[model samples]
Target chain A: MQTEEEFRDFILNGHLYYIPHVTIDCAIFGYHAQQLKLLLIKHRNIDNWSLPGGYIKRAEKLLDAANRNIKDRTGIDNLFLQQFKTFGDPDRIQFDKFDKKKWLEDTGLPSWEGNWLINQTISVGFYAITDFSKTRLQTDFITEACAWFDINNLPPLEYDHDEMVQEAMHTMRLHLYHYPIGLNMLPEKFTLSEIHALYETLLGKKLDVSNFPKKLLALRLLKKLDEKRSIGAHRSPHLYSFDKEMYALALKEGLVLS
Target chain B: MQTEEEFRDFILNGHLYYIPHVTIDCAIFGYHAQQLKLLLIKHRNIDNWSLPGGYIKRAEKLLDAANRNIKDRTGIDNLFLQQFKTFGDPDRIQFDKFDKKKWLEDTGLPSWEGNWLINQTISVGFYAITDFSKTRLQTDFITEACAWFDINNLPPLEYDHDEMVQEAMHTMRLHLYHYPIGLNMLPEKFTLSEIHALYETLLGKKLDVSNFPKKLLALRLLKKLDEKRSIGAHRSPHLYSFDKEMYALALKEGLVLS
Candidate 1:
């Protein structure tokens, strides 16, 4: 709880050196157009792709680091962020082959005496759901370009990032059983078919529409709107929004079958 | 993939030592008779009370560390172990008074340079549900006495260990909604009244005996046995053991009545 001037002085001096060793990486996944997508960035160092990550500064909290990561990469803050797990296996990184030592020597940067440039990385994994259409993407110093890729056709990610992405997806699937995950993926005022399609994609199968609506209606977690969809066949389907309170109660007490 | 000798040498005298910084702390809990109980240890360091925990070895996984912790303290290896969460706040340790400098000076140990001693202490929270009858507790180098205390009355614990216990209890309560937790807490071949009493304690309320039996029977997760309890003045009650597959299914799909 030091003052601004004191904090500035501490940062300038070596007493409060920011531990650049710790970094926060996020596995941002969203459903769009009936497909699961992951946010990724191509790194400049090894020309390999990876999830958007940033180093944790000394003053910031772990969740703050996650927020900064999401902001730095996609310019989207205050989304549904949850810490899934931490990756701390010694073989999590292969920096020896990356030639980080040579790069440091070439740059004339003083050698890091601590576990800064070693295999002692403790990465905190955060799973986020964002409005992909509203994201303002930015490519920082380490990355070349950032984009969203369909999870099915993802390229080989650098380090153990692919494993992290898989873990995040697994957590998302577990949460999706109760929560309305499609609401985050789809735009506002979506049709019944649109929501159904997203659910089908996540479940990875075709479900009978007759039984599906009956089950969803029984739960009463959705609100049928007056407005109908402008596209599709002559008889357009009505739009629906999630009944927040009912869904929350359903999450707590769990959905009941008719 | 390395040979046995090579792997041994790598771990023992490795280039950069992979110190097992991670630890598992178990707040073994049980509700007996009418009072809740918590397992704790009197630490040798500064004569403080601490949770039973130890440094995780390089060879074992996180779950192995928890099992090892429980085995080291209680001399009982076969117990229920569940990984609830990991606590990793950077300032989680008291650094100002008993800082890293004091710790290094006190130990008079070797470099231990690779060990992230003071900077970060990420602990995995695990809890065990034991009958309290089977435990043969032991003391280690840093532990003086291992004993169980009434949950309502607990001694001050070291290093946010109290919060960790509360977290374990929170997880147990969440699990109770789906699965039966007091099964291990009670003795084998427990009476129906005893089972109901344990559930009442866990639920923190006295349930109607009539409705309780009906609802519990409907779940079909328990198997009624012919053995009768031969104790107390009341009529001998029937005994029951949980059906493993049925219990697991009920746990996955929560048996909610509301």
Candidate 2:
């Protein structure tokens, strides 16, 4: 929603153009310099931090809706987004902070309870990893501010978002074993040590350095390039790049790496 | 809906008591004696096989709604259920098989185009594995028949259910590696050979018997019982049982089994 009129229309008639009772929340993980961050937005009226999310358009597919929300916030395209879990507790949206009276006063609306926006909702949660340094965070009329927060230092979030983050983290960590990552988050050609560090950082633990690279290489998802990077007098590490076909296959059919 | 009045009320005013545009579909995979099957329900109005599913009540949690649907159809409780995926394609429900005219004629309902049930829907897909021999299939007013069909020999299903089954199967297979299973699917005391066979049947492929049991044992999720089951004089084999504590822990915190 762009203007007050659009917001009012959406609050009243969004059910006509958007699928009511179902929304999408995104956990955008950012990785850079071996540190992970999460993108959070401050709602304009509510003044609370939350995962960036929005309603699905009537004609849009679920993935398309998730992708649109991602693009609208991060100003980055082509990040690999995934649905982690859906939250649908009957009281999930109940909070004193909703403040229907405040909403009516702020928007010049006549009533609030019967509005399409005030119903029980079930939210589909999606998560994606992108290079933090590459994204330009954007905000909309309803979102006052958007920024990246260190994952471990996130403030108390609104509604059931804390639970959503925990589940997203769990699913994303499990997925690190099954799906190939670092497509856009890593350098085009990198050494084994670099990729090993990437996995260690994403998994948020110490992976056996000896075993991590070997497992990646064993998957045959990486192709060794003849070029080598010389870091010092006697150390030249061989660089490798992802084999596009194999990487795609791993993404689709999944792989086992532990 | 149990009667014509209830069905008519649901068609016209279900949005008042149900979450509009959201439904739940279950892929009930039944396993027994090295055979795998799926529980399917033939819709009375459409006269086509479909994964048993229903709308979520306004006051119900997602899992409770799923459990209610499962128990209503199969008379089984406490089976392990997992959410595989949520499907939301605009044309996913636009099948010619819905037969609005037939629904109106059969139920004495009014025009259906603007009915809440006629809107585009997003379905949360869940899957559960249960022993087929134990469940007593039950049918409600809308369900003409409920039965198990061999997984490999299933008839064409209705309304994006084929896609739901495919996704559910893929997730369930991947989960076998991450989560503990075979609590109800296997006997209380089973041999290594028997457990291995269960995995092979569920996976629909042969596992390295030598490695499969060893990997499972390495997780320490099972215990070796003192007694052995004697078949022939020299063919007796030691039996094993699940360490309930360890199995529950593994179920909560996923472990790498493959």
Clashing pairs for predicted structure model 1, backbone only: none
Q: Model 1 scores what on Cα lDDT?
A: 0.65
Segments of candidate 1 deviating more than 4 angstroms: A1-23, A45-48, A94-115, A178-183, A188-193, A203-239, A243-258, B1-24, B27-38, B42-50, B54-60, B74-80, B94-120, B127-131, B149-159, B166-258
Who wins the lDDT comparison? 2
As a whole number from 0 to 100, the lDDT of residue A153 in candidate 1 is 93
Computed on C-alpha atoms, the DockQ of candidate 2 is 0.79
Worst 10 residues of 1 chain A by lDDT: A1-10
Lowest lDDT sum, 10 consecutive residues, model 2 chain B, at: B107-116
Per-candidate interface C-alpha RMSD? 5.1, 0.8
TM-scores of the candidates in the order shown: 0.67, 0.95
DockQ for model 1 equals 0.13
Give the C-alpha miss distance for residue A15 in model 1, angstroms: 11
lDDT of 2: 0.85
Docking class of 1: incorrect
Best by DockQ: 2
